[model samples]
Target: MKDKKPRVAIQGIRASFHEEAAFIHFGEDIQTIECSSFKQTFEALQNKEADYVVMAIENSIAGSILPNYSLMMSYNFPVVGEVYLPIQLHLLALPGVKFEDVKYVTSHPIAIRQCIDFFDEYPHLKVVESSDTAACAKRIREEELTDTVAIANTLAAKLYGLDIMERRIESNKKNFTRFLILTHHENVEKKDIDKASLCFQVSNQVGALAKVLQIFAEQNINMSKIQSMPVLGKRNEYNFYVDVEWDNTKQYDTAIRQVLKYTHNFNILGEYQRHEDEFVQNEREQKFRAQEKITRKYINVKKIVK
Candidate 1:
C-alpha cells in the first residue's frame, strides 16, 4: 500500500496564504486540513488530526498577532520552522463583474486593512470583514455573488475562477507575513541550527530588562525580534517573546543559561535552523531529484469543505 500523505492544518481554506506557506515548506505532497480560525488550527494539532500546523505569527505592516502569542504559551507546541510569504492582495470578482458592480468587498480584517488605499478611492463600496481571505473568494464563487468582491491572494483568484479587478491592491507592496510551523513532537536538534524563539517574564524593576539584553550582547547573540504582551491575570507584568540568531550554538547556550537566572517562567519555544538554510537545503534536494529523474506531483485545485 502507498504511504498516506501528511496532514497539515492551516487557519483558512485551501489556496489561502497559510496553505501557500505550508506548500512552500512541506511541498504539495501533503494534505491540507482547512480550519476556520487560528485556535482551531492549534486544536487540530492537539487532537492529532494533523501532523503539522501553519500559523501566521506576524506581518511586517501590521505587526504581531498578539492572540497567537498567548495561544503558543498555552499550547507549548514546538515551532519547527517558519516561512515568510509576500502578500499581494487583489480585488477579485466574477468574470462579467465590473468595478461599478462591486457594492461590497470582503476579506480577513488584516487583508482589508492592507488594501485600505484602494478602498479609500471608492468610498461607496462597503468593506466587510470575513474570517478568511480565501474564504471570501470561495463564498463569492459558491454563491455566485456578482455584487460582491473579495480582496485575496492570486492563488485564491485562480482557484475560485475570479477575475482580478485590481492587482497588487495592498497599500504596501513589500508586505510579508511570517508563519510559524508547529508540531507536537520535540524538534530534533540540528548542527546548523541558528535561530530560536523564546518567551519569559522578568521582575518589575528598573534595569531588569536591560540586564538581559546586556547578557545577550556579551554572548554575541543577535536579537532579531522582540515583542511584549501583558501577562494574563497579572497587573502591569508583561511576558516577552524574543527571537534570537546565533553564530555559535555554545554561545547561545551560555547566554540562555545566564538569562534564566534573571527570568521567571522561562521557556525556549524552539531552536531550529533558519528558513534561509532550509531553502538552500530544499534547492539541493530538488536538484538531486532532478538528476535522478524522480517525479513529484502537485495539487493546484482543492475543494472548499464549507
Candidate 2:
C-alpha cells in the first residue's frame, strides 16, 4: 500500500513563516493543516488530526515565545526536530500600488514592532495590527485594498499575487525564528540525538541553581540557551528552561542524572539531533557591543515565560 502523506499542522495559513518552517523540516511533499492559533495547533495533535506540529519557539530579536513554552508544558508533546527560519519581513502591496497611495499598513503586531524603524520615517501612515502576518496580505489581495499595504514575507507576496514594495523591512536583518517540530509519540534515537530541552525548578537555597549548572559543566555538556519564568501562584519561585548540547551520548546521560539531584518538578521537554553547527549558531547571535539599543522590558508574564 502507498504511504499517506504526513499531516503537519501550523499556526497560520500557508506561506506564513510557520508553513515555511514546516516545509523546511518535513519537505513540501507533506500536507499542511492551517490553524488560527497556537492552541489550535496543539489541539490538532491531541485530536490526531495531524501527525506533527511546527511551532515557533523563539526569535533572535523578540526572544522566546512564552505562550508556546506553556503550550509545550501543557501538551507534553515530543519535539522530534527543529528548524530555524530567517524572519525577512517585507512591504507587500497590490500591483501598481505605490508608497504614496498607502493610507495604512497592517500586519501581526510582532511583525510591526520589528519594523518600527521603517514606520518611524513615515508617521502619516497608520499602523493596523492583525492576528497573522500572512492573513494581512491575504486580506489585502482578497479585498483589493489599494490604500493599505501588509507587512509580510515574500512567500505571502507570491501567494497573494502582490508586489513587494520594500524588501527586508525588519529592524534587524539577522532576525530568525527558531521552530520546534513536535509529535505525539516519542522518538528514541539516542545515538543520533545531541541536544535536549527541559524545564526544572531549583530550591531557593544558595547554590541551588548553580549546582545543576555545575553538573552540566563538569560533564562537558554545552548549554545553548537558558531562560526563566515565574511559577504561577508560587511567590518568589521560578522555573528554568534550558537547551543543552553534547558531543558524547554518555556525557548527556550523566548530566541528566546529575541534574535530577538538584532540581524539582523537572521535565525533559525533548531530545533531538542538533540543528546546526557552531558556526551557524554563532552567526545567528546579535552583537550589541558596538551599537546603541533601547532597553526592552517585560511588563507582565504568564506562568510560562522564556
Candidate 3:
C-alpha cells in the first residue's frame, strides 16, 4: 500500500495562488482542503481536517494581513515553515473572446489593486472586485460569459481554458506574497532551527522596547519583521509580534533567554527554518519587465472605449 498524502488547507479554490503556494511548499501530490477565509483555514486545522495550512501573511504590494495576525494570536498555531509566491497577475478571457469583448474585469481586491496602473490606462474598462481571483475565472467558464475577463494567475488560465488576454498586468513585476505554513506536527530539531516568531508586550517607558531590541542586537540576532497590534480592551498596551533570524543558534538562544526578562506575556509562537527569496540569479531574471512591448491584443489599440 502507498503512504497517505498530506492534507493541506488553503484560503481559496484550486488553481488559486494559495493552492500554488501549498504546491510549492509541499509536493504536488498532497490533498488540498479549499477554505473560504483565513479563519476557516485555521479552523480546519483545529478540527483535524487538515495536516497543515498555507496562509498568506504578507505581500510586497499589500503589506501585512492584520486579521490573520489576530487569528495567530487566538489559535497560537506553530508555524513550521514559510513559502514565497511571486504574484504574477494576468488578464484571462474565453477562447474566442477578444479584448474588445471584455467590458468588465474582475479579481480579488488585492490582485485588482496590483493592476491599477494597467486599468488606469484603460478607463473605459470597468474593474469589479470579487472574492477570489480563480473564482472569477471559474465563473466566467462555467457561466460561459464572453463579456467578462478575469485577473488571475497562469494556472487559472490553463485550468479554465481561458486565453491570456494580457500578460504581466500587475503594477509591480517583482511583487510576491509570503505565506506561513502552520501545522500541529513539527519535525524540526533544535540545532537545525535558525528562525523564530515571538510575541510580547513592553512598558510605556521611553527605553522599554529599546532595551529588548538591544539584547538581540548585542547577541547578533537579525530581527527581520516587527509589527504591533493593539490589545482589544486596553488603551496604550499593544502586542508586538517579531520575527528573528540568526546564523548562530547559540546567539539566538542567548538573546531569547535575555529577552524574557524585559518583556511581558512573552510567547514563542513558533520556531522554524527561514525562507529566503533569491531576487536575481541570472541576467534574464535581473532585466526590467516591459509590458507595452508584450504581444497582447490591447497594445496595438491606442485607447479602449467602454
Candidate 4:
C-alpha cells in the first residue's frame, strides 16, 4: 500500500512566506493547505486535517508576533522545528500602471510598516491593511485595479502576474522572519539535529530567573533566542520561550533538570536540529564541540581507573 503524503497547513494563500517556510522544512513532496487566518491554520492541524502547521513567530524588524505567541500557549500543538527566511518587500501593480499612477496601496500591516519610509514619500497614497501581503496582491489582480498597488513579496507579485513597480521597498535591507513547524505528535524523532526550544515560567522571587539562566551558563549551553509572554491564568505572571543549541552529550538534560528545580512550569516544546543550509549549524557545531570536551574529560577519568 502507498503511504499518504504529509499535508502541512499554513496561514495565507499561495505565495505566502509561511508556505515557503513549509516547503523549506518539509520539502516538495508534502502537500500544503492554506488557511485565511492563524486560528484556522491551528484548527486544521488540531482537527487532524493537516499533518503539520507552519507559522511565523517573529520578524527581525518588528520583533515577536504577540498574537501568535499567545496562540502557541493556548494551542495543543508542539513546535517541532524552525525555519528562517530573508524577506524582500516589493510594490506591485498591473503591467501598464506606472508608479505615478498609484493612488492607494494595500498589504499586511507588517509589510506596510516595513515599507513605511517608501509609502511616506508618497503623501498622496493611502495605505490600507489586508489579511496578508499575498492576499493584497490577489485582490489587486482580481479587481484589475490599475491605480492601486500592493506591497508584497516578489513571490506574490510573480504568483499574481503583477509587475513590480518597486523592488526591495522595505526600509531595512536585512529583514527576515522566523517560522515554527508544529505537529500534534510529540514522539517524532529528529535526525541531523542541533537546536531545541522550551517554554518555562520562573518563580517570582528575585534572582529566580537568573538562577535558571546560570544553569545554561555553567553547562556552557548556548542560548540563541529568548522571549517572555504573560501567563494567562495568573495576573502579571510571565513565562519564557527559549531556543538553545542541542549538544550531543547529556548536558541538556542536566541543565533542564536544574532549571526545573527552581521553576515548576517547564515544558519541552521540541528538540530538533538546526537547518543545515543556514549559519545556525555552524554555531551549533561550536557548542557541540564544547560538549565533546566535557565527554572526553569523563572518559579520561575512567581510563585512570583501569
Each prediction's whole-model lDDT (CA): 0.88, 0.87, 0.87, 0.83
**Which residue segments of model 3 deviate by more than 4 Å?**
185-191, 280-306
What TM-score number comes out for model 1?
0.87
What's the C-alpha lDDT at position 276 in model 2? 71
Best by TM-score: 2
Q: Across residues 74-155, which tens digit of lDDT does each residue of candidate 4 receive?
A: 7857777888887898889988998887888998998888887897788899888888888889999999998899888878
How does each model score on TM-score? 0.87, 0.89, 0.89, 0.87
Residue pairs that clash (backbone atoms under 3 angstroms), model 1:
none
lDDT preference between candidates 1 and 2, better one: 1
Cα displacement (angstroms), candidate 3, residue 16, comes to 0.8
Quote the lDDT for 221 in model 1.
95
Each model's backbone clash number:
0, 0, 0, 2
Per-residue lDDT tens digits for candidate 3, residues 1-306, read: 037888999998999999999988887999999999999999999999988889999998989998888898898788888887889999999888989877999999999988889989999999889989999999999999899999999999999999998899999988899899898744334446778989999998899999999999999897988999998999999999999988898899899899999999999888887765674233224342434345354645635542
What local lDDT does model 3 show for residue 34?
A: 93
In candidate 4, how many Å is residue 262 off? 0.9
lDDT of 2 at 11: 90
Q: Which window of 10 residues has the lowest lDDT sum in candidate 4?
A: 275-284
Model 2 TM-score is 0.89
